[model samples]
Target chain A: MSATNLNWRAIAAIYRFEMARFFRTAGQSLATPVITTSLYFVVFGAAIGGRMGEIDGVGYGAFIVPGLIMLSVLTESLNNAAFGIYFPRWTGTSYELLSAPVSPFEIVSGYVGAAATKSVILGLVILATASLFVPIQILHPLWMIGFLALTALSFCLFGFITGIWAQSWEQLQVIPMLVITPLTFLGGAFYSIDMLPGVWKTVALFNPIVYLVSGFRWAFYGNADVAVGISLAATLGFLVACLGVVWWIFRTGYRLKP
Target chain B: MRPILELDGLTKTYASGLQALKPTTLAIREGEIFALLGPNGAGKTTLIGLICGLLRPSGGVVRVAGLDIVEDYRRARSLIGLVPQELATEMFETPFAAMNFSRGLFGRPPDHALVERLLRELSLWDKRKDRIQTLSGGMKRRVMIAKALAHEPRLLFLDEPTAGVDVELRRDMWALVRRLRDTGVTVILTTHYIEEAEEMADRIGVIDKGRLILVEDKATLMRKLGSKQLTVQLQERLEAVPEALARWRLTLKDDGHALEYRFDTQAEENGIPALLRQLHELGIGLKDLATEQSSLEDIFVSLTRKAA
Candidate 1:
């Protein structure tokens, strides 16, 4: 614990520096999430709410609210973290960070922490924005908070890995655009897995984003297509795996070493 | 005198099948400015990177303050600071914040006074609050130097510290380096500018094709390899040199309008009198005469070529 404590100063410095950088353009980093979520509600909630009725004892708009918000949180967390790290590399500012005496763990924690902070702030803004569109009931605030933390952490770790692996700007967009966005859409963010056919329901479980969205949905509405524990477990597992990969990359110096 | 840094048989082979740094051995004594002179692909950066623990060597060992850089990285790195060749600093950070952050990374307690001193010396104190991106290229380079010196390491590695900069920044950097050396810091610098090494280095090491060709005291290296040349401008052109003039081993240029002779000043006898007499015997008339001595650039090029 003390050894880890020794890294807090460095980690805090990095986290503060990165967070300050993110906040420099608060219009894009903070406001975009609120606007994006509001738009999602306008298109999906007002337009399609009349036909779908309620999902699992909740209105369709309300059913998708938590999922949509969580989706934004995860993706933005990952994207922010990935882009944050990638920017330094692209701009050649990574040399400054690399030459410093900060340990790899501190560097990792600082970046992921900033990413998580941004994602959480965005999620909160989206949550507040969604309240204007439809009534949202919270079944368990503690469970909801747990779900938010787990989902944000896992996705931020994924983003951290993406940042480390990315070599170019195009490469940065490929994962978020081609892989992450599609995963969110197919992860049952807008629809419950119960609405899926037999084979598709089973396949949806394999998408990690599905578990995250389902778990967050369960926290809000007390209804889910899958068990929250299993989703939580999956999120935890993914977080661990991501941490392992990040540690390995740092230890080997991978692409970070000059 | 104890060596603050030593490289023994260090070699690096990149994945692209390029041998970046060959096996080499050298020592950097404490409180001296040692310059590593090489061309673009001469592995100067690679060598510095290995010493700084930024790059892993494929073979051999590097010791800092008698600590193996690989085995005791934390301790070794704590005692060393590296100013990389590239001017890479966080554009979003202010110089003060960046330097403070760098000091934090080294696990050192906050030393505002020290950082302030470094900032002032680097001429960045006035711009301490300004964003790095807003600073000019030369200012950013100075920030790099400040960041490297933040920890106050005993051994400092400056890779091409004066690559691209205005004369003012260059002069300031050199002055700061000398000040650091005076304060008992050992500086190991790599530069393509021969004059930078010639003007600043107490000792010079020439590396070529990833191998260290020679390492000697600056004055000694020059005196040992330096050559002097005497040039005499003839009053008139001659079709060919006479047999007596041949004894001077002089080469007539511009159809005998000039005669160039080379001699070693270190030799027991330079034979300048004999050469002048031979020119007289050949009826060669001189309009003007002058002598020039070899510089570090000439010695570097010749050493590298000879090794190749």
Candidate 2:
């Protein structure tokens, strides 16, 4: 068989394998994001919105809605891809997959694709679910789709790296939960960065997730706390950096080496 | 016969400063069952991993079916199948899906009859619809083998294929391995069970401390180094071996009820007759005598012990 034909087959297998694994536990994979996003809306939007009337002409409930949706999408996408790849390692079944004729490119694409799918689906669910509480208005439908695609792709790649680096379950949760989640929340997921002190506002711009949330929020409201151009540039920059790391890991075989 | 697989100074050293495989060279011919017998931590798995393209060799080259494992990895990997020690499969997946998916991983088209035949051969046809997690340990192992064989690889690596398995499954597995060999599939197995190698291996290779100690045909290995023991059950108890029989280095066992003599089978004169004659001269009467042949386990222990 041709080399291209061989690679395509390996890629399909890895993708199918990863997809089957995630879907095997669809309850935790699919439902958990919806439920968690719902709680975020109720607690951060409804409960917290009871006092804070408005932030930048938008109601507090609606203002945090885009940020929360993006937060869920980014974290879950990254988590699923990372955890999905890492599961084979923990279970010792990774040996079987690695021993197969699949190339690293195929391996990465399969896992990232499955993870991006999960992230996108969950992001849409959160968007739909949030509309029930406060109508979600998409200012630029095209930009919104772009934001969703980039956010999911970037985080999914990041998550794949996390999976390779992580040796244990605790290690797996550390980056997404402790590092990424905190950065997202403090990056102005709820209140605008404009409300923060001048010095803190500048520091928040350095947070990659801040640009992701801002870019995605701009897609929804057209009025973002930061420049859309800067947000898009930062998001793209983060994606490139992440892609570089993943490509390097695959080249070296990293932890996937037996 | 041309070598089906060849390793040229292959080595693997983990980043942790542990040398998993020492630089070693070896060759395995086509249509032969080569058993790699090694104790745990002897680098058997590392060699298998490198040959199958799971781990990068630290400082050597490996060629599978004449294809370089590293430089021509895609072709090399396509020609081989590895039945790993671990039982890795999705809890929700059926045997059919897992095997088909694995075959597809190698870019093979869907062949339901091949999949079904492999399943039935492994005695997994009835359980093909069952989730892998639900199967018994022995059955799960079979599924692993079936999955490995799904792509119809010319070479198969069974790393401790029978480890931690039941007797019935072990026997069935060996039988299946022989059948696979009959169909021209080269089998390279790493086993802790010396008897398994003795029973199934056409050629035996021993690895220890990340080094390849020896590689030879099973019969040749045994015949060259194998020994025979003469055990005599005496009719009367003797306090000690006769002084005249001291040259024999004989052993007195069970309070001198029996005498044991070890001799190389390959020796021109086995010296058993001389020992027996000496015993008769010493008035050491024998009730009954039996001979036992040395096993592959004996040869393996002696080889590893000598290297240590």
Candidate 3:
């Protein structure tokens, strides 16, 4: 066991433990994301699309699927990761994990990996459920998977940071409910930023989720409000920031150690 | 023989400016049952927390099984198991599953046989398939011990293992601890229960208010405290202890019906025979004789109280 060597066994155990918790409430965990996304597709994609016409050469219904996917992916990614780490802390089980023969890196990777895996599965499920109502076409399938994974991975990392930072259960929801959910809605999840007026559109460009939604939407329609390269960079930069926060948490043992 | 564990200047001063543990150095021999006896808030758990890596030390080093806990934590941690004061997370997990997962956390490959044996030893084999939440509090505690032993760590720390347990379970846990020590595991347990240390420990360490006040072999400590007392009953009540038997420092009690003589158990001379001869020479007769020795609990309270 070299100092820097990875312990795949520990990572797998933590991941499996988290995934087991997910399966124990499999119906609720999987249903909430897929059902919420499906409802969004039904209301915004169908009911609303029927009243509204096409946007940018794509059916209004089809245009919102990627946005809807990004919406569920972002919220669920934060949720799963945040709750995953927070429950252990709240329950005092984190001590067992911290005391074990595990490196901080292994612990983070295990948690982030499990949360990301769940979010990606939910994203794909929502996408599948969306295709039933709207005629969907992914122009670049590989980029769609790549972008989907990158967003889920990065957001899940953010959620992990939130989990460590949060001192209470209410704190866990502050970022996601107040900050992330509203940001996703305003970032063009329901409608393209193109519909906004000049000033509003420029302001929308400042929203980080706009890049995530635009890049994700481009993978489906071959067009994006923000350049794909810039979107990728923004997402990458955010991922690095979350990674930095996680490293600091583990090093200082922030709330993890007492 | 080299020590199985060593603490060199181990200290913990919390961020709140409280020194939870002062500079402490100790060594534990392999296969020895070492009991850390301390009253509440006596830095017992703090010491265990440092060695187990749950709490970072403000100063110093810990080496377990010859590996430095800080620099060689990977190897050092794997060699240590901690039965923490709190029940660990994984209430939804089965005892078997939790133990296996815990063993893997130490980087041990899956060994179903070992898991089965540990569950059986902890009396959890029948409930191995049950979710830990479904078990009673006592059973849940057994699951914690099983999980700790899953990795077969050479050094095991039990932090207040029997704190809330029933008498039967406490006895069973003690027996299991002895069995583990017999298998060559060095067991370091912290308990405020003086009887637990007196009954189970080969050596006892008394810590108080962030300091190691004393550490000695159990019997040797009892002898050093010299708590033996012999009470003699005279056939007739005496108005006072006669001057002829003053050399024995006997205290007359029960209106002089009883004369008590205290002696150090470890001393070369208890002076019991000489005292009786002197009493005979002084024409003092006894109806009966009785002797009593002070318990470890007495020593513990007195030590901690004096330290305070």
* Winning model by TM-score: 3
RMSD of each: 2.3, 2.5, 2.0
Q: Write the per-residue lDDT of candidate 1 for residues B1-308, one digit (tens) a residue.
A: 66898889999998788999989999889899999998888999999877776776889999888998877766788888888888788888899998988887777778999999999988888999999999999999899889888888999889899888988888888998999999999999999889999999999998888988889999998888898999989898877767666666878786668888888868888888888877777677879989999998989989988998
Residue-level lDDT of model 1, residues A1-258, one tens digit each, is: 357545576787778777887788888887777888888888889887868888888998888888888778878988988987888888776765675556777788889898998888888888888999999999988988888977788788889889989998888888889998899999999998889999999998889888888888888988877888988888899999999999898878888884
The ten-residue window of minimal lDDT in model 1 chain A covers: A1-10
* Candidates ranked by TM-score: 3, 1, 2
Comparing 1 with 2 on DockQ, the higher-scoring candidate is 2
Interface RMS for model 2: 1.8
Q: Could you tally the backbone clashes for each prediction? A: 0, 0, 0
Which rank order by DockQ, best down to worst?
A: 3, 2, 1
* lDDT at residue A248 of model 3 (Cα atoms): 91
Tens digit of per-residue lDDT, candidate 2, span A60-161: 888888888888887888888988789888877777677777777778778898889878878887888888888677889899989998889989999999
Model 1 chain B is weakest, by summed lDDT over 10 consecutive residues, at: B239-248
lDDT, candidate 3, equals 0.89
Candidate 2: tens digits of C-alpha lDDT, residues B1-308: 66899889999998888998888999899999999999999999888988887787789888888888777877788889988887777656898998988898877888999999999999999999998889998898898899899989999999999999989889999999999999999999999999999999999999999999999999999999999999999999988887898888989998989989999989999998888888788788899999998999999999999999
Model 1 CA lDDT for position B38: 89
lDDT of 3 by residue, B118-223 (tens): 8888888999999888998889888888888888889999999998899999999999999999899999999878889999999999999999999999999897
Q: Could you give me the TM-score of model 2 versus the true structure?
A: 0.93
RMSD of 3: 2.0
Give every collision pair in model 3: none
